[model samples]
Target: MDYNFLKSLHIIFVVSWFAGLFYLPRLLVYHVEAQEKDAQAREILSKQFEKMEKLLFNAIMIPAMFLTWITGLSMIYLTWWDSFGSHTWLHLKLCFVVGITIYHFVCRHLIRKFRASEFILTGGQLRLFNEIATILLVAVVFLVIAKNTFDMLMGMGGFIIFAIVIMAAVTIVKKIRSNA
Candidate 1:
């Protein structure tokens, strides 16, 4: 019932949620890449990834996201949303959370698509997609920690640049691996 307890739990679930957000996409990359193998090998690995993906979604990602919302909303309610509801920083952070929640469901859709061997996204595209979450995470974390003092415009610009760098690095790595 205490605010501090809810905050702590919220933090814990936030961490868990981000962990799943980070990893599930990576699993997708692996799953899609596995399709390049011979049919038998691809079947075996796809099945394995299917199990891992399901377990991660059901056991970790979904639950953690739910709890993160529960604990976070509890804190807001318990405090009467006094200082939070009107804050621009909180608004921006919540918008990012909303974006990622949509992203989470999109990932679920991707899982089903992949399960049925309907690969709309290539492995490299999926890698770039994963960076979207990373960029959102950076923005949300900075917003929460900086609050009113945060510079949203500057931070968002920086995140865009950071995401571009990450994608470029991934591209370089992929090229190197392919050329090797």
Candidate 2:
């Protein structure tokens, strides 16, 4: 298989997977917020959100994640098998990918909890939680684009700053929504 072809497939699936990762949390937030509705509305919204979450996670996210892994590993095996150790950026990117993989399963767990009517986190917290994928996406994209020239210390500092900004923005949005 051509490396470029595999790279393209990897990119496609990565985008698909990230779309799920990004949207699933928003669904969870909606699910949490739906609890504040009237009893009948809450029941209807909860069931609908659960079904949507299940369909999104199972039909889209899980498959995309698997294909992303397969295509990614295939590319690595084809191009970097011999010189893999020297690619610090690849290592960092893989670390972030692992983080994303963990995040994906954690989402599944959250769905299950929601199915059981276990709303553990507030809507605001879940809104903040959704930014985890954003952070990982930024880190992974930076590592890939920067590749061999990537600086670890600078990246970490940038991630911390970005995270603080995201948290502050979420807080402000929560405040604005409450006031509205």
Candidate 3:
């Protein structure tokens, strides 16, 4: 395969992986909220959501994650492995990737919990947890694209501030909903 073609495939898989990451948690939020409904409705929603989670995890997320890794490693071996080893930005990106990988499996565990009718996390808390992947995605993309041109200290500070802002927004929205 051509280099560009392989790279494009990798990008496609990465996007798919992210799509799973984003949507699966949202489904969990819905599943959790379903508890508020009557028993029959809650049972239907939980079963549907459980099936959706399994299909999304197996059909999309896992395959995409592996393909992304395969293409990524292939690209590194074919072209930039040595340069990657020397780059601070790549190192940061790898750390984020590892973090995302952990998040991926944690979500898988969450799917199992949902399937088993184990409602450990509340809907609001799951909503907060769902934002974690987005945060990591932002960090990885910024690290790669910005490279050394971006300020590390400033970026860290900004990320902390961003998390705070997100949390505050969620809380404010919750309060508004409750009052209304």
- Each prediction's whole-model lDDT (CA): 0.89, 0.94, 0.89
lDDT of 1 by residue, 1-180 (tens): 878888999999989988988999999999999999999999999999999999999999999999998887787677747776578877777888999999999999999999999998998889888888888888888887887787778888887888889889889987998899
lDDT of the structure predicted as candidate 3: 0.89
Q: What is the C-alpha RMSD of each candidate to the true structure, in Å?
A: 1.5, 1.0, 1.4
Regions of candidate 2 where Cα sits further than 4 Å from its true position = none
lDDT of each residue in 49-102, candidate 2, tens digit only: 999999999999999999999999999899999999998888888999999999
Model 3 CA deviation exceeding 4 Å by range: none
Per-candidate TM-score against the hidden true structure: 0.93, 0.97, 0.94
Question: Which residue pairs in model 3 clash with each other?
Answer: none
2: Cα error in model 3, Å:
3.2
Q: Which is better, 1 or 2, measured by lDDT?
A: 2
Model 1 residue runs over 4 Å out of place are 83-85
RMSD of 3: 1.4
